[model samples]
Target: MQAWQAGAHPRSAPGLADLPFALGVASGTPSHQGVVLWTRLAVVDPLDPRVHTVRWELAEDEGFQRIVQRGQTETQQALGHAVHVELQGLPADRWFHYRFMVGDAVSPVGRTRTLPAPDSPAGRLRLAFASCQRWEHGYYAAWRHAAAQSLDLVVFLGDYIYEYASPRSGLAPQAATPIHRVHELRRAVSLADYRDRYALHKSDPDLQAAHAACPWLLTWDDHEVENDYAGLQGREGASAEFMAQRAAAYQAFYENMPLPASVLVQGLQGLNQADALRLYQRHAFGRLARFHVLDDRQYRAVQACRNPSESSAGTVRPSRCAELRDPSRSLLGAAQEQWLAQGLAQDSRPGGPRWTVLAQQTLFSPRHYGGASAAAQADEPTPTDPWDGYPGARQRLLHSLQATPPRNTVLIGGDIHQNYVCRVHADPDRPDSPVLASEFCGTSISSHSGATLERAQALQKNNPHVLLANPEQRGYALVELNPQRWQTTLMAVDQPGRADSALRPLARFVVEDGRAGPQRES
Candidate 1:
């Protein structure tokens, strides 16, 4: 199916015969017949409000040696100096390289690939999912390594850019966490801000290489907007004005992303433009695997970071029980939950596919460090921000799986900024029972690490479901799958600042048919 169905229109702007500083080019959300390509024309000074035409050429070879699809489109300064072209009629399951031109300026070349045939046979699939990259904390060394490897797809699970300004302190646990002036905050709330943010991120050679390497499936987490926002609410609290600000945040986000115009037309209104725009959709990787992308932050209830203290106690500390357990709370919301349940049921049918992978954010497994003696565990006032906080929502999802029981179901997640391999179960105590599923959570490409190694040792002992957990590492996880076996390599980049950062295999884990969990160090 074509991702974009073009309609007749009078040219809103002049054709590529005029512009300068053709900023960026990206091909995203590929499909059988078409792929969406993006380019933004930048005028040297006093960004003009003129119409400019742009042309994109997609080829089977890197040199544009074999052109398969070509198109010309116009961009207007009113539309944030951007051009989005959806090129159709390309063959399915093939790699294509595309470039854009506006006037005399040329955009960087990018590579994108389409989904496999709708009914192809189960064979092989390779994917890399990573998240929580803070540019100021470290370099994108792991992304550089990942881009060099051949892969079917990349799933970026949010924190694409942090909303807050740089932290004054280097680490997370500093006593006086340096905070940027609230007024000085560069929260991205406008089209230019979003464009500039993307430009800054794209300036990283590693991120550029990775985008050039494969098509990405993206989902937004709290950092993209405000921390732990529910619908239009903002942190510190929610209000109508806050919601308006949120709307601006969402619009800025859509403007910079590789999404189609349909999603972009929300116009600073933080509501669904179309019911069919499922942030969580299913994609088949040949016949080998199916991926279910999810958005958990959009539909959740506004959670108070900590419960208010009781008057009887007369203390300002958090209450023992926050409202996180509210039964009505949701992660994927009602519509998305239904879509995912239906997709899981249909994809896991007998002899349908080899694997069912849920590419999402946050860890699904429950972990508790309440009883730990380690400083890291004892120091933290609350549990990690994960699905573990929403027992009801997590249970609902687990029950959904229990009902469908897809064979070879695996969960892939990246948001905790740590590497983890765990066995997801309907009941963690009964690990030997009919295995529900398994999960591989990737560490950050170059973000803050979790607890120190000394503390991680104690935390791991308490969390048995977590087969492996590395908090101090910076890198990505590579999952290799075939019809019979699945293997994962957790590679850690030495450091980010150095130009020649090397990725080393920190751990290797494998899972075979009928196994509920992974076998470590194999």
Candidate 2:
């Protein structure tokens, strides 16, 4: 049979080589015995099929000398020359190491684990989620730290790659460098550009180690396509041709990431044609935690930054803003809103998990950081790119949480590149009002840090509901859960630019039973 033919093994063919270690072997969306293992073959030439039959072996030990499960799968350029092996018959809540093979070549081994069985005795689960790792700004020291700490999973909440071109003049001293190559100081255009972009960032050993460490649940934000791109409406004039180009970019994104077959085979024409996008999914960690990953950019309404001349210092009323007040405007869109509402409601039903986690991008809190007097100060204005920009939708979600609040609904977010701990109040103005839920916004893993220490003081003075806000920090959040309380620790790296980046505990928080918010824990 020909190499392209189904069930054809490449061992008999000439010039066949094992997958490159650059792609790395990793898994996602873990189940009891079945999990997804992924890898991308390096291409020296695009015309040649690069067709190879890869053998995957999983074992309980780091050294697969004692293999438990083994399988072989065919790979072709059609799927970006990527191999995704779904292994079954594995035990629950157990660690497994796997490797890929082709002809005489062997791929790097990776570690992965499966979720505990449903209704299994409640056990401890450790998960770390992060976002906004701009390549130009800093290094991925945080990801390295996360890999060192043994965790069950890592949820990447978007801005995985920036859509902007690098500054013509080098970045400011404190700024990050762009990961993708640029021409004419414009965003990337072709698939090769996007592919090379991922190649640049993925070259980071820390990020690769994190993927090798555990299963990753990922979703995209605006930067993956275009800045603040909402459907076909781009922030800076998304023409039809540009939209088509954006579609190409999205397809390239799928080709590069370690996504599943279900997600990879979504549409017919190619992986990029609607069918390959896997933005949202739910993962139940036994009966302890339920994570609802979301896709905000695809369904969200295009955002418009508020005019600086129209507001005050402490409380800028954004209700007059067209994008903010558009009731039809949605951050999660109607479909995703329904999905979230249904998930929230289900978590409260008997037999559901204790914590209903929203693994999403961007802050869900309503905060006007523009400082009330923008109208008089004539500053540019507040970037209405967050939940603060979609008040109606925010209100809708808030009301949903308040009406039938889940047992423990905590929203984990990223994208703004800051750490925020706030009590999600149904009414922020009402100090004594019952808090509906709590939000633990993780700072960027290695993105730019804001003036967190300084902003903490201003936020305290302006927003009372926010228990703590750290605008200056490059770190990740570790969320520990139990039936009674949820403990979260903000772990920050001492210096990302330095080679030996040391991490330390920046802060800790805990939410007691029945409380709608978190408190800084001693």
Candidate 3:
């Protein structure tokens, strides 16, 4: 049994050491002078809905001697005994250490940094983007490696946790087996179940280290609640029951993440659950880059008439479903689309950001058939679970970029387990179409991609826009943004399933100033 799950003691029965701060420490959503901090109090039985006061502090140094900002807050049972401190009035573009204290219990110190002045000419940013981490899939060696890099920021795209259930008692990773881990409950159906699941995943040392290493910008894909749920509607249409389930899931998500209170799930605002939580937001690094974090799932008109939850429904040709051409349907919804357009337009005008990055979940660029993998070669429809499934929305996004293309725009996405480098085109069919931006689809931290290298090579041959594809590796993209160029290193881990795996630099691609496509750096 894990240390925190040792017994069935009541809330006040156990000492501070045995009862609180079980999820470690995390910080996120950094502005030039503000950031959010997070942690959940642990207990022998998490069901204890008692109020616990937590003290938090910020320091310029790792040691607590140099105190900067300190305060206290109480975690209420209504919010799952969790705390999110949105600290403001800090300096710009510098590192800070922070921690939480619950009575005698203390959390590990975490490092976080605010963005530089909006007009400052920032030098470089070494940021890593990752997504689709299924706890039951493999060890979090990738997170350990990322933590060691001392990244300024980590962009978590989605799938932070999976919904598969586990045993009610004696939960643990199975020995001598593939898919090494076993869950404790049935697929998470209630708020308590989701809380238990988060506690379980947070217990991993590597995950904790990653959280302590840097601030994170996170969003949920499907697994955070249910598989392929979009907006008020789920994989199955929205129902009163599903709304309740979604509300519970959203509350659980808010409680677990290091997000600001602005996105906190207060209660059901409407039947659609439109007011549950809003995660889509923007972040800019002075004149270096601007990141438009998107929410494709929340407001999307379910995946083009097909069930997005099913792997077999998406990845199709226009002939399979012609309504995909309907421009009225949107992935970002009309309001967010306009919001993104205006932001990009503002950035595209007169000596703006050196780079524009759409930090989101799911791949943006297209991947055609004729690859070596049997599936790729089968001439079957491509997966529509991502942008590929929402052609109209993708086209509109591409059209907007083409109209006012941002300088060295780069789209960073995750979901597909393989790594890919492609150039986005106004017309996906026209290989020579005006390149609106560049795309780097980072491979998964450890999720499985059932494709082979030979198939990937075949895909590259057929898809002219695709420059590189690695179907059988698991790792993240180490991105370095400079004033004149944006470089992304494909860091592939030797073994994802192994806890002691190592990350090796597989390839590097660079997009120079005023450039629209990637040039591989050897």
Candidate 4:
């Protein structure tokens, strides 16, 4: 065991005052055996190849008197000076506090916990899932409020950082609240640009607090690289240059996040992130809930019926786009589709989890829009960016699901920048389609929905399975999973630009045991 004063500075190194741990420390991807600890070394010359030593300590109590784990690790410049310490053999289902030290300065103390032993009977699990946090739109008050809650884990669905240039440059939604601040650099292209972007976003105190509060299981969406990228194909079209940019972005993403080393690997071509991390993996919280994290960005074909630069990319009339219904298109790709099918079958067995959570970016349930009349909607097509665009892929999973349909499967999603609670049927349009799943789509933490509130609310009428929809609010969802039932309360922030905003619960939905859908609690 190492002994030293909690805040003692044995040696003061140069450039340390510039904030060595500028991005802060975090922990995540925890299991019954252990958890991963993360931190980035911010220096004047970020690309320096010299290795820097960082000391870390974990304890049962907030103070150092109860130190449980202590060690020192060196972060080489080649990996962007990011340290990911995978600590194993820790006791399960217990809270732990950790901090990092360089010279005398210390990083904020973070709290994290490992899951209960797999298959062990669980009592209650508090999980808060959110996504789509555009840096320029609003303050991260949502994160500040969420940190104060009693949460076991935080699942960030995607869009951890937007790759586009700052909204102040007039690229953001026009109706959004005025920018509270600006980003560090232009659209992220090189590795340095991406690293600076992550640093800019992490600089937020509220976001830092949220990471320090608990561990997070994260996946990416379009904005992390670029909006609506399809595999190697970018919005501008696929090319060697674009792939190189993607490689840099992927490496930068892995450097900033608390993902395990299993997710980061260099292939013959370059960094193959999707292949390495195997994002479509499952985790069980004892017997209470099973979280299946998905990557909707990789392996999917390009958006059909519309181009990226078009103004109406997200909306189109079905009659005008025959290719939208092509049977060859896919969203989750082929291999993941098969993997999910097997997982669903295994989970549907007689003794399965009480709740199966499908955590991913973008919406799953279909949404049609055109006019007030069903005939008018029949004239329109749903956005291709979400499952609505890939009916064939959606049908494939829905078919497999309708066959066995995992126990109490509940879909939690972000992106679309709105809150929606709906029932998922094999065919969203059919009057008598069997409801196979339940979906709870939370709004963005700060990103604005370009559509007006009335336009978003009007969607509820076009889609009957929708019990509730709100586009005006900005915040996240609070979900509690137990053996008996699962409850999700939609929490919204009244002021998106205000850092001191409170998270007021807008609505609550409950999924009963053995039921296939969620019902309005009120």
What total of clashing residue pairs does each candidate reach?
3, 16, 16, 1
TM-score result, candidate 2: 0.87
- Predicted candidate 4, C-alpha RMSD: 5.1
Cα lDDT tens digits for candidate 3, 1-522: 222333333555343335466578999999999999888877654556667778999999988888889999987877777888998999999889998987666788899989998988998988999987776667788888999986989999988887765333324345332364555456787888788778777888899999989999888788887877766765445477777777778788888999987774454343235745778888888889889998887788766657544533445556666666677887778888999999889889886898999988888887777443445534447565688777788888888898888777899988888899998888887787788789999988877787889988988888888999887778888988889889899988887767789889989999988878898998
Arrange candidates, best TM-score first. Answer: 4, 3, 2, 1
Which candidate tops lDDT? 4
Candidate 1: tens digits of C-alpha lDDT, residues 222-301: 77765555543333443555555455556555555676666543443424333223366676776678778898877665
Task: Note each model's CA RMSD in angstroms.
Answer: 7.2, 6.4, 3.7, 5.1
What are the runs in model 2 whose C-alpha is more than 4 Å off? 1-19, 171-186, 234-238, 264-276, 304-320, 370-382, 450-452
Candidate 3: residue 483 lDDT (0-100): 91
With candidate 2 superimposed using the best TM-score fit, by how many Å does residue 517's alpha carbon deviate from the native? Answer: 1.1
lDDT (CA) per prediction: 0.67, 0.72, 0.80, 0.81
Question: Against the true structure, what is each candidate's TM-score?
Answer: 0.85, 0.87, 0.91, 0.92
Candidate 4 lDDT tens digits, 32-88: 879999998776666456677899999999887899889999987767788899999
* Most TM-score-accurate candidate: 4
lDDT of 1: 0.67
Evaluation by lDDT, superior candidate among 3 and 4 = 4
